[model samples]
Target: MNIITLYHGSGGKGTHELIDNIFYKYFYNKILDQQGDSSIINNINGRIAITTDSYVIEPIFFPGGDIGKLSVCGTVNDLAVVGAIPLYLTAGFIIEEGFDVNDLEKIAISMANAAKKAGVKIIAGDTKVVEKGKGDKIYINTAGIGSLRNDVNLGIANIEVGDKIIVSGTLGDHGTAILCKRQDLNFETEIESDCNALNGLIEEILNSKLKIRFMRDITRGGLATVLNEITNHREQGILLDQNCIPVREEVSGVCEILGVDPLYIANEGRVLVVVASEHSEKVLDIIRNNPLGKEAAVIGEVVKDKYGRVLLQTNIRGTRILDMAEAEIIPRIC
Candidate 1:
């Protein structure tokens, strides 16, 4: 069929055809080829990390990546930040009845390529078709499994005064790109989404055996929400230097025009790292050496005063509270 139909989800002839032509064709692997009710993964050692997320991005396709790529990366990063080695992924698709078959194949191809690059397998998946207008063109849900590192112990409770707050790269690229695309805003330079898998980058730091207090992937709620969430009800507060936070000129300009705070903008590829002061410099050096972390910087520190608060020291040397985002600034942003 040129376009998805309800029959494709009936678990009969049409369903088999759809699975064989697209899902099975692209996501082929030894484990997936078995075609069993569930994938059997063995030889796993140490603690296991599993994360699941649903992607309903407004536009199925975006600047640097699409919803398919976003689904895999989002799930993988969730595991990576928890100090895990990502190994397998399961993707589920919900396509509108009238969705284009070519588009579906493109998305499947993107997912396959992304999984390959992330060194993970798409072991199993499910697909469903809904009535036209009952759903968006497409939506994706993914679950990732990983093995936790025995040497690494990370948590917010480990945060102590004088610990450094490091962001892997500039902020707001992903949110800004989605906004510009949805609003049809034009600019001198293109603002592409920073969506990417961070397992490799995270592994590099974990391999160093540094003293990491905590690590989190910068996603939906952005840095502001993450900082506020971690510092909330805690003995130690976090103080951020406005000038120290890395932000691309293009992103800053976009935020200014749109009257949006970059700190509240979502980032898919960036990571927030908290490490002891002594190991901060070495951690920064290691992050900077990687392509995904070239713009990494120590933006803040845990403080003893202003407990349970996130304070930002502005470029003008004035401090202000950076609270959790109360409302959604942009919708359907992965």
Candidate 2:
């Protein structure tokens, strides 16, 4: 019997094998070895950006984008979240022995086009082949490096009480779309992953508001995980107005039916922003003008609280704890 099973996608035992055998080994530069959520590369002549991620979404193809397009955009968006001018990317591929060459060509072309759209280049890459069953059709690992604008200093440390929190667009599209594709679930409204590159939107916001405190792409763990990260660190609570949070009816219906929370579902093309209250409108305008952030909205605020927690105020004016979900959602989701 093949020891390989679906469990490999879990964040537990099988995930450890995949990371240890493939990811950590090949990506084992001294910098990544440090493992600080993201890689910290030195020798950056000026402001620098670095991000690393792996893509193993099931089915490889989706409604709006493919794994290839996702690989490029994902890297660019990571740098964008940091207020960086994304300029370069590195893609690594692990292909099973009997994969499709024509499809691989399509994947490569899509990546190239995505990089071009994001105004970046794929400067370096690596490829490997594995035994058929040991690997999926193909897995992509991407690492990106970009230069930050000298004037922009976006980070979690910039978050503060009274700062307004914003979401670039609607939520739960990515996870719902992927789940829909993998399973037989059907609905009147189809939700496509908001897969996109946000460098342009970031650039627009930076030009308009230099004081923008923090920004992050709502990726695997979605908006909730990101907000929790800040609360856990700053010892401040994030209070979100239920009405202010943007969600398409399709996405909301899907979540309600499937027992998932839109807040925790993955979002590919959305950004979470924390900025000064007074400048929130200015930042919002900059985002609205950009195509990537047209649906941008002010969703929440940072507040003084005894507990470092994230709370959601419902439409009924009641507050509930928005805790992180324990189960691995949409495994290999990134």
lDDT of 1 by residue, 75-131 (tens): 999999999999999988888998999999999999999999999999999989899
Q: In terms of TM-score, which candidate is strongest?
A: 1
User: What TM-score would you give candidate 2 relative to the actual structure?
Assistant: 0.85
Stretches of candidate 1 above 4 Å error?
none
lDDT of each: 0.92, 0.80
What pairs collide in candidate 1?
none
| Model 1: how far residue 75 lies from native, Å | 0.5
After superposition on all C-alphas, the RMSD of every candidate to the true structure, in Å, is: 1.0, 8.0
For residues 242-297, what per-residue lDDT tens digits would candidate 2 score against the true structure?
A: 99998888888878877888889888899998999999988888888888788899
